[model samples]
Target: MLKRICIILICFIALLANPLQAKDIIFYGGDKNSYNHQILHHALSYQQHTNYLVKTYTGYAPKQRAYLNLSNQEEIDVVFGGATIEREQLNHAIRIPLLKGLNGWRIPLVNKKNGNIFKNLSSTEEFKQLLAGQFHLWSDVVVLQSNNIRVHKATNVKGMYQMLHKGRFDYFPRSILEVWSDMERHKQLDIMVEQHTLIHYPSAYYFYVNYQDVRLIKDITSGLESAIKDGSFDKLFNQHYGEQINKVKQTLRKTYQLTNPHLPPKTPLSRKELWLDLNMHPTT
Candidate 1:
């Protein structure tokens, strides 16, 4: 009886040390600065006493797609952010809106004939035939096809943009922030540029995990619960980023992020509106 008890005790201690059982896991993320890292850091900090560890796979969005697809194949334990009506069909992700923020990409380059995306914009229906798992650039046809709007598989965003500028495609999608950043490099190109709404995205973000790891998923949910109750989560969010919620109804006047390289005439964003609009951007 004593011998049997000794064996059971050893097994119990072993279980406690093993990360697979105690907690320590790798997560896949789109990028290091993304909101995924924020949520993961918050969860681990809250559960550090419990010995849980969370790691991330940081890379670009294109690479992230490939990594996520692989995880889904094995359905292993993984944590990430990003969601869409189409991706939901796979059903391996647990849908939880970690936070809400503004996220939209406009096509800056357009067909020479259309003049500019901001002007000749037609409709999203103009695209719907994507070439799965294949693409090289960001072009009008690439966006239409990749989003299943038209028909083709492009390799990456840079490639698509090249095609757009070459007039091979009508437009290429880019976030306001991204475009704001990119325009800095192509200042002279603005002469042939215009923003398009076909690439508009209202809301896009989520905290999710693999389907095969049910136990890990529960741990994540529980960790978040604990963080929320103690105000740890909000505290962390505000610490890294100032208070996001604000009361500004007078004017959308935003603070001049003079940082915007391609700013047409240097419009000033009200200081009050600066942080407020950023609340929508979320740094990530």
Candidate 2:
């Protein structure tokens, strides 16, 4: 009996020291200060709602097509991108709008000398005459081209910026959440925000997980819903983008509404609280 008791004690100690490990949910993101990093951090916050740990693997792919395709292969556990019907067919989208549809609110970047050029333009037809820079694979490219807007496609971010600097495009539309920081980083390129106009479309940014990883999808969906109900999601969004919203409100820019043909039919537009109404002035 004494020998049996000794063996049990040793086994219990070993179990204590080697407890079960938490499952790792791989996150593929961009470098620091990029929108990808912001999405990765938001995904990491979901960890509080699940036993699985989120681990970021940066620089997995520099282009949207590459990373999104990686998710299809199960090489990447999660990827953040604009929601589209085609994208939904490829991966399991969490379906919660990460930015509350703010990704569709585009502000343009243009040469400082030409900034005043857009101030007087009031129609999409006039805007279409100007060349816009965008990624070749971005859904926005399709939207722009469908609307008869001229586009200059670049495979990478730096190349796009260089193209803009070289006068290849008249304006580069950037999300309200991304334009400011991006401007600061590329100040040497001599671009300025087109203060007189903004673009509006119906779009959402969503976290898409591998279709085979149903467990992770459920965990993230539950976490996001809980965060929304508890107001934590809005708090985090306001903390990061509230100032930008306020600044946009102060500018009396003429907004041109564009149709996002790629938006999925099942988008949660009924959840009013999950979106920002540009018509109503932001109080933040």
Best by TM-score: 2
lDDT of 1 at 240: 42
Give the Cα lDDT of each candidate: 0.45, 0.76
lDDT (tens digit, per residue) of candidate 1 on 133-237: 225442333333434454334567555545555555544444444544565565444223442232333333445565665665666777766776786765655
How do the predictions measure up, each by TM-score? 0.49, 0.74
Quickly count the clashes in candidate 2. 0
- The clash numbers for all candidates, in the given order, read 33, 0
Model 1 regions more than 4 Å off: 1-22, 30-34, 57-76, 84-92, 98-107, 110-157, 188-204, 222-284
lDDT of 2 by residue, 150-252 (tens): 9988899778877777777899999988898889999998688887777878888888777887767776777778778888778777877899999888887
